[model samples]
Every structure is written in C-alpha cells, then in structure tokens.
Target: MDNWNILLESTNDGFTIATVLEVPDCQIRDETKEGAVEKVQQLLQKRLDKAEIIKIPTPIQPSTLENPVMRFAGIFRDDPDFIEIMKEIRAEREQDSDL
Candidate 1:
C-alpha cells in the first residue's frame, strides 16, 4: 500500500488548500481540509487507473570523498573581506551585461 502525505493550509477566505507531497501539481481547495484531501485522493486514483508505474535503476557513481575540490567548500568563511567582495560581485552582476 502507498501512502500520500497531504499538507493543509488555511486561507483568509474560509477555505483550505491541500497539496500532496509526492505528487506534483496535485492541489485541491475546499471549504474543509478533509474535503480537499479526499478530493485530491480521488483525483490521484483516477490518474492511477489509466497509468502504470515503473522504476529505472541508475548506475552507481564514484564517491565525492575522493574528489580533490571537495575540501574548498567553506574556504572563504573566515575571510573578513569576503562580504565586501561578494557585495561588489553582486553589484557588478546587477549592471547591464555587454554580451
């Protein structure tokens, strides 16, 4: 059996919005949270009735621990000039590009 996690949010207009965690674009809105969840489940069932689920195995890759560049992740964390440098970089990026 598959379980779907539903997230509920209350709106200012006295309505509830429901979204399924595992399903993309599976959102429902109703007067009650339970009603939205139920409606989304029904819609998922309708889709499942006409589709098939398949799994594709991906090839295993080498571990990142052996990579030489992995040690520089936080190389500039202690640099006091990093923030000013980053600000200058961001200001440059915001300007019009010549390309």
Candidate 2:
C-alpha cells in the first residue's frame, strides 16, 4: 500500500473534511475526522489501484558546457570580498524583513 498524508479541516456546518495531500480532488466530508479520512483513503486507493510512478531516461544535461551561465560559475570563487558581500546582503534582507 502506498502511504499518503491526510489533511483534516472542520467545516462551518459541523462536518469534518478530509483531503489526501497533493491530491485536491481526493476529498470527503463526514461527521467525524476519522470518517472523512477513511472515505478519502478509500477513494485514493481505488484511483491509484492501477496507477504508478515511473521515471524516464532523458538525454538532456542539467549544466551543459555550452550554457552561457557556465562562464560565470567560478568567477567569484577567487574573490576575497565575496564573503563580505554575502554578509551585507543577508543583513539587508533581515533589515527589510524587520520593517
């Protein structure tokens, strides 16, 4: 059996809603959280009974040598001021967030 996470929520009408995480359509509403979760689980199980996840081999290279960004890959590696620049950037971000 494939393990799936369940999200539970209380409805305004006193019913409990249970949704299978990552699957917006796999949901159910019931009088109790357990009942709602059980219904959603059954629904998900039935839907995925004949379904599966598979990987496909690809010829694409993530960081190809011909890519333009590769030219800047190690340009800052030898910069002595890079550490101070990163520290200044972090301090600026924290200051902005404080506002």
Candidate 3:
C-alpha cells in the first residue's frame, strides 16, 4: 500500500474538503474534517482496487532563510525599529476595531 499526502481545508460554509495531493481528481467534502478524510481514504482504496495507477507526490522542499524569496519576505523586519513599529501598528488597528 502506498502512502499519500492529503490536504484538508476548512471552508467558510462549515465544511471540510480533502484532496489527495498525488491524485488531483480525488477530492471529498463533508461537514466534519474527519468525515472528509474517511471519504478520501475509501475513494483511494476503491481506485486502487480497480487497478488505477497513482503516483506518489514528490516531497516539498524545505523553506530556508537563505532562499532569496524567503529572505525578501521579511524585508519589513529590516527596519531597526521593527518591534516598536509593529506594536504601534497593532495598537492603531485595535483602536480602529473598537470604533
């Protein structure tokens, strides 16, 4: 039995959707997260029983601070006074939210 990675996302409509990363066509949705997962498992088993071919997904590369994209993502923190800046921003947002 091949192990596959499943992605679960919660919807605003109060449903959980499950998708098998390796098999794009294999998706299931249910009211609860567990139900969605159970359905996907059964769906996968059925496909396997039918002799369908499914490829195992390649593992995702680990993100590192050394990567340019990752390094650039934190550009806002390059400011020497980032901690104070964030505190002020949060305080302003909280004040606005309370209005």
Candidate 4:
C-alpha cells in the first residue's frame, strides 16, 4: 500500500489542495479535491501498469471558517467519495461484461 499526502487551502474564491504524490520528480498537484484523486489515479496508472495496489491519500477535510455557501458547494460538487464510489461501480460492471 502507498500513502499520499494532500493539503487543502482556502482562498477568497474557493478551496484548493496540493497532493504530494512523489518526493520531487513524480508529484502531482491537484487544486481541487476530486482533481487530486484523479491525478493520483493517473499517476499510479502511469507508474504501475497492471499491479493492483491499494492507494490511500489524506483527505481534504472541510473548514468551518469557509462561507456556508462555499462549504455547501464543496460538499455537493467536490465530494470525492461520491465520485469514487460511482467509478468503482462502473468499473465493476465493465469487468463483469468480460466474464
């Protein structure tokens, strides 16, 4: 299992995060939470061709200081867990087709 570190920063407009995937050479910085996850997936797919390795990244916990509207936007639009779950289901269905 490989672990990745991520940080979420707040701005006047919205929130963004940078994912520290690799040390220096192969790190990916995804501004948004969901984007960071997609970036990690892309990195792994590039590095490892077909080996199944469990990947865990530090989640971007929401901040209470953020505006309610911004927080709501983050909750509904940038929910990485929700997106990932859908992706897993889609992938499972695709694999089942080959059986």
Candidate 5:
C-alpha cells in the first residue's frame, strides 16, 4: 500500500499543499484542496494502470526480514506496527478459514 503525507494549509478559499509519495520523490498538487486530492487520486490510478503494463523497478526493503510488509513498512507500505497488526489479523483469518 502507498501512503502520502498531506500538509493542508489554510488559505482564502481552503487548504492547499503538495501531496508527496512517502517513499519516492513523486509528487503533485493543485490550488484547490479537494481538487488537488482528486487529481492526485486520478494521477495515482493512471500510474497504477501504467505500472501494470510496464516493468517497474522494485522498491527498497526495510531492515527487518519478516515479510514484504515488514520489508517495506514505514516506507512504501506504512507504519511497521500497523503492518504487523494487519498481518496478524490476516493470519487469524487464514487459520479460521481452515477450520
């Protein structure tokens, strides 16, 4: 999962700031807050679609070598603790499925 750090600043109309990818240097922004968000979503979707069609470079891994979540946690995926929590939940689900 990809996450962005959105810095909203109050303006005459509303808030505004650049939406940057937490991992890579990719970023985009719009004058309008809502419009900026929508545009970013659209841009992300386009990139995702294009990524599906092209060969992209793999992201860097974390120091921990548990799973992909741990490998890229806090960088590409998200918070390490949250990722581990989700992993535990998934494990429970899989275990429940077998029963």
Candidate 6:
C-alpha cells in the first residue's frame, strides 16, 4: 500500500476541498471534511485500479547549501562551459574577498 499526504481546505462557500499531495490530479469536495477525505480516497482507489502499473519516484529531501549531497546535484559532466563558468564564479568571489 502506498501512503499519500492529503491537504484539506475550507472554502468560503462552506465546502471542504481535499487534495492528494502526491497525486495532484486527485481532488474532491464535500460539505464536511470527513466526506471530502472519503471521496478523495475513493477517487485515489479508482485511479490505482485503472492503472496496470504505478511507478512512484523516491521523494527528494529538502536540500540546503550545507548538504554535501545536494551540492553536487546540479553538476553536469557534458556541459562544455561548466568549468569556465566555475572559474569565472571563483574569480569573482576571490575579487570580492580581496576587497
């Protein structure tokens, strides 16, 4: 079984809207919060039943500059100007530090 995070919001018109965070397409509305959740679950189940196979990608952790793993996430080996761009950035930083 897959776990899904559901978001609920109450509208000005007195309807509760439920949205599945993992599956943006799954959304439902009801007069009560409980009903909205039940509807969303049914909708999600239908979606699962219709699909032959479902592939869920691993969720990425929130990254910061201090995270070593995330620091290298954007490095691209095939980019020809990558090294030159890094050099230019380094030079600019060095100039800033010198001032």
The number of the candidate with the highest TM-score is 1
- TM-score for candidate 1, please give it: 0.60
Candidate 5 to truth, TM: 0.35
The CA lDDT of each predicted structure is: 0.85, 0.86, 0.89, 0.62, 0.64, 0.91
TM-score of each: 0.60, 0.55, 0.51, 0.29, 0.35, 0.53
Candidate 4: deviation at residue 45, Å?
4.0
User: CA shift at 68, candidate 6, in angstroms?
Assistant: 9.8
Question: What does candidate 4's lDDT look like per residue over 1-99, in tens digits?
Answer: 556654444445554444443533444455566776677567755767755557899766567456767645646457788889879999999999989
| lDDT over C-alpha atoms for residue 24 of model 5 | 41
Instruction: Answer with 2 or 4, whichever has the higher lDDT.
Output: 2
> Which parts of model 1 have CA positions greater than 4 angstroms off?
64-99
Candidate 2: worst-modelled 10 consecutive residues by lDDT = 60-69
Model 2 gets an lDDT of: 0.86
Between candidates 3 and 4, the lDDT winner: 3
- RMSD values for the candidates in order, in angstroms, are 13.5, 8.6, 11.5, 22.1, 15.6, 10.4
Tell me which of candidates 1 and 3 scores higher on lDDT.
Answer: 3
Q: Per-residue alpha-carbon lDDT of model 2 for 7-97, expressed as tens digits?
A: 8999899999998887888889999988898889888988888778789997877666487877789888878799789889999999999
Write the candidate numbers in order of decreasing lDDT. 6, 3, 2, 1, 5, 4
Measured by lDDT, the strongest candidate is 6
Better by lDDT, candidate 3 or 2: 3
lDDT per residue for candidate 1 within 1-99, as digits (tens), equals 798898889999999988888786888899998899899898888878998999999876667446778778789988879978998988888784743
Per-residue error (Å), model 5, residue 7: 4.4
